[model samples]
Target: MPNPDNSTPPIPSSVLILGSGVFGLSTALSLSTHPSFTHSTITLVDRSAFPAPDSASIDTSRIIRADYADPAYSALAAKASKHWRGEWGADGRYDEVGLCLVADSGKAEYVKKSLQNVQGLVKSGARQAGQGRAGKDSVQVLDTREEIERVMNTGGGSGESGYVNWASGWADAEAAMRYCRRKVEELGRVNFRKAEAKSLLYSGNKVIGVELVDGGRILADLTVVATGAWSGKLVDLRGIASATGQVLAYLDITQEEQDRLGKIPVLLNMSTGIFVIPPRDRVLKVARHAYGYSNPTRVPHPEKHSESMVVSLPRTKVDEPDQWIPREGELACRKALREMIPSLGDRPFSYTRICWYTDTPTGDWLITHHPCYEGLFLATGGSGHGFKFLPVIGDKIVDCILGKTPEEFRDKWSWPEKGKEDGVWTDDGSRGGKKGSVLDEEMRKGSRL
Candidate 1:
């Protein structure tokens, strides 16, 4: 018989986090700060190295506070922005430089509607919470294309003619992730393992521990899976299922295109369905929002930025967060950016990278206790906005671990009652008829088209 001491200690409380991304680290840091978690140990597991040499290579940081059309996400983002600047320390890593939404004259109506809702929400509760305060609230709304042009001129124009907002920006993504990870590591209660999780050890319906790729069995009282893209595969082993999404990013311009891509406020070009983020140096960042691949797999190692360019090659099912840069992808992204913003012209791209998103049919993140497992928690399906909510997610995840469900958390991530098969259902307008779930009827009303 196995020694009783070797099994989980009676009333065990240690937590095993199954990824090193922002979600895993953020949860570890928050648990350290939690009053009830003083005695708990947090074991963070990630295949990524400790102190990633290239921050961007590990996970590109694209932080923003733009309120989404979805109210639930807006609320979550507002809380996250506060924690990033307040809890994580403003000067630590995340910088609130503000963000702007841009659109062409033809799509002015769409931009206006979206911004109206965002502005209303911001002005209503966000301002009271100090989530955002537009440049003295003087020019919160840019009604004219000429005004946008003037602001664009001052911010080192996007190279293309379009209307712009003045009071928005982006955070240093690479720096923010690094800072969060560092803070978590500094907490003496947590241990980061440089190994991959090979399988889960379960008893009856509960997970008892995880078997590492190296064959070490590190047991835990509870397990939290924040595996991002590899989540589907990891969960599949345990009979849990999720969808994967593939995303890519490209440098906006090279060092030579200083006049065109530098000093620009981060922009979300609604007309083009693209987001343009201004990084340090002359390089700008650009990527499509609507286009993405489904059924992505994880790659144990990072890939180069070059391998991602070929549209012909079967899309790689990267299971892990790889940083390989495909040369052709780098060239293609740079060219596409130039086409979008003519000012980029013929400048070369310095680098490019790919990342993955855990997706859901209802488009809401699945961050709760596993429906079937008693001691397992989930923090996945951010729908691409998970990183921005790292700070707030940490607090909620810890609460879930401690068995105290907060009111705010209950409202945001409550489990769906419908669509058990494909995990999809249309919102039926009940008191709990939240819009961002698998059953959201409104958002996908015409999805068949």
Candidate 2:
């Protein structure tokens, strides 16, 4: 990847981002927004040109507002949602059509339990804030199918029913990404470069900068790896696994059919592990859970789920950053959707896309310092719930980089957990693993600079 034309002034500080995905762009946006970053040069390197709506070149349509079943994730999502609304202003780009989690009688029991759990957290948070009523109003558990239908119709402005409502929602991924990038550009110091990082440049144990694929080197005082699925290639040089997971989407219904289902809330069917989001455009975006993948070297499932990536891909390399288009066997997924909804059986697909997820072994986010590498930050292993936290993920990373102690994050996003005698060092580095070392070396290096 080439640097900006030499005719222009050099970047203030060489902040190099390896990937141009949502996470990478979000981090850059957060940094560019900081008061101290007024003159700090920030560069975002990616494989594609600036993305736009309807551009198949880059798929940024992965954002969601669904709260997770896990406490760590629910807390993270809650924070991210707040940040998103704050930054975007009222109706910035996301449509808060609310989220619907549909399930059968048996699966509804699980949904009910999960709703109870989320309600307890919300009430607890509000009570601490001195609010009188429990926030349980946000997590109503619908009993009758008619009640489910009424909630979906009235809540989402769709005027239709037959969908269960959950305490979650949807956002326009492309719009949100563009909003962040525009905010970054507003700073004028942040640089958006079209490049691909080849390797991390290191001075002994400390990382200095990144070398691009096309022979360009961008120096950085601090380097962060927000490269999502492709992070493996960048961090494995330091001996950490990136654990790639595959995700696929299908638009089985026609544009007319999708329009007929206008503004439907994002629906998550936990029983089948499928999510259907109704975008403004005449398209229904459906994605299945990343069950697991046989390539354990590239992916790890904490739930003991069966491997499903290879089974999901279409012969060609689908997991790569630039190469993801549906081929074969994707129709089977559409067929399954048709079986579930019945309305989708005859409708032709608008388009199908495949995406990748970077998973950690423990299921919790592996937001930690790179072992043995100073000045390098590793932000991967978000599992499948990374996008839901995009609004605050960048802020947290920036907080970490600024040396300010993020009290909540410090207690939550810890070192990866070790499973058995796998020899994988998963400590927060306080007990037996290496944690504080990276920060210490980074401080020392910065002082020398």
Candidate 3:
């Protein structure tokens, strides 16, 4: 354990953030916005070139709803929604389409809390609005099953359903991230670049820098590993975090169908694990969130989770090698849409791809300091729900680095949860390799419109 300079600075003079996705970029941008960090040397690194094509943050649209069973997210989303309204606005980037919460029986813990929270907030806002106070929180009950079916244009679209927070909508994720990166760069202290971080460069009990995949090393006073799904490989995250693959398909609906369902809100079928995003430019997105794919026996659960950056490559082979959408995923998605929006017809998907999620047990992000290494921080563990907090999550990261994170959320993001038992690869049987991958022939078709 030799020190590069045998120095340990109380505050980081230079900060290196790995990954350029939503979490990494947000932390970088938030650092630049800070009064002291404005002049600090900050570098944002990414494995891919500008706007990584396959990055989760590169999706065409991202849901901005705050309908979480946990009120922390709901309240935070309420705060960020205000900024999105004033800043992003309806300038072709953000929308206020809201999210339609549909459930199998409507009694699910997640769905029930969502409806109660949203409706309560909406009523509170309404009372305030009557007294000359105005806010965006708005909720509307679908009333009868007939109304839900009518909205979905199916005889039985959902058993229980409602719309939450008319202010909640979808945002162009890539556009927003690009905007944030530009703003961070304009601050003059932050630089964005393309480079893959191989591992952490440690000296004694402190992390001094990161080793690049290209044999070069970046030495920084503080290093933040925000690489998301790729995080476990570079560090011994153990079960605290691991990569799980999910599917996303882009479908092109007829103008008639688009007109009918375009203005409709996002479809969140909590039971069916299908999320049908709002139709944008006649292209609708369908995503499934449930049991996912992991590195089967190749990656077993680690006994302890920590800040150790040891490269333990997972050998478990993914069913879909070329990253194509599988037939299993396709059929499941179609079935969900068919049940939810029967009017859309049983058409084929235009484009589909598989994406990996860095999952955690509680679904809370891991934005805390490394237990074993000084000058090292863990800013990953998005767990598939990290995008919506893009606007403010970075600020909290700064707080954690500066020892200012609020008391309530610190434990949730910290170690020793109920069950950090992850890193095991569980297959969902969603791949239909018989036709090769989805990128092969029929899965993705160029838009003919």
Leading candidate by lDDT? 3
| Candidate 3: tens digits of C-alpha lDDT, residues 309-427 | 33213221144344555566777777777776776647777777777777675567777777667878888877677777788888987877776665667676765343434453322
lDDT of 1 by residue, 364-431 (tens): 66667666665667776555556677667778666655555555556445444534443222121101
Ranking by lDDT: 3, 1, 2
Top candidate (TM-score): 3
How far is 283's C-alpha from truth in model 2 (Å)? 1.6
Q: How much lDDT does candidate 2 score?
A: 0.51
TM-score of each: 0.73, 0.71, 0.83
After aligning candidate 3 to the native by TM-score, how far in Å is the CA of 362 from where it should be?
A: 1.0
Clashing pairs in 2: 1-214, 13-41, 99-168, 149-162, 244-298, 429-433, 429-435
The parts of candidate 1 lying over 4 Å away from their true place are 1-12, 51-60, 83-92, 95-97, 103-114, 128-139, 143-147, 154-167, 237-249, 252-261, 295-336, 403-412, 415-449
Task: Give the per-residue lDDT digits (tens) of candidate 2, residues 1-449.
Answer: 11111121223355666665566777787777777666677877776676622222134345454344555555666666665555662463555555666565544444555555566667777212211113435555555656655554522221112233233555666666667677778867667778777778878777888888899888986677776655655655112333332335545455776666656556665555565566455556656553322122333221122531111111113333343333322443464456434566455555554444454444456555554566676666555556666667777766655544255555444443344332122221101112112212322333210
Scored against the true structure, residue 25 in model 1 reaches a CA lDDT of: 75
Report lDDT (CA) for all predictions: 0.53, 0.51, 0.67
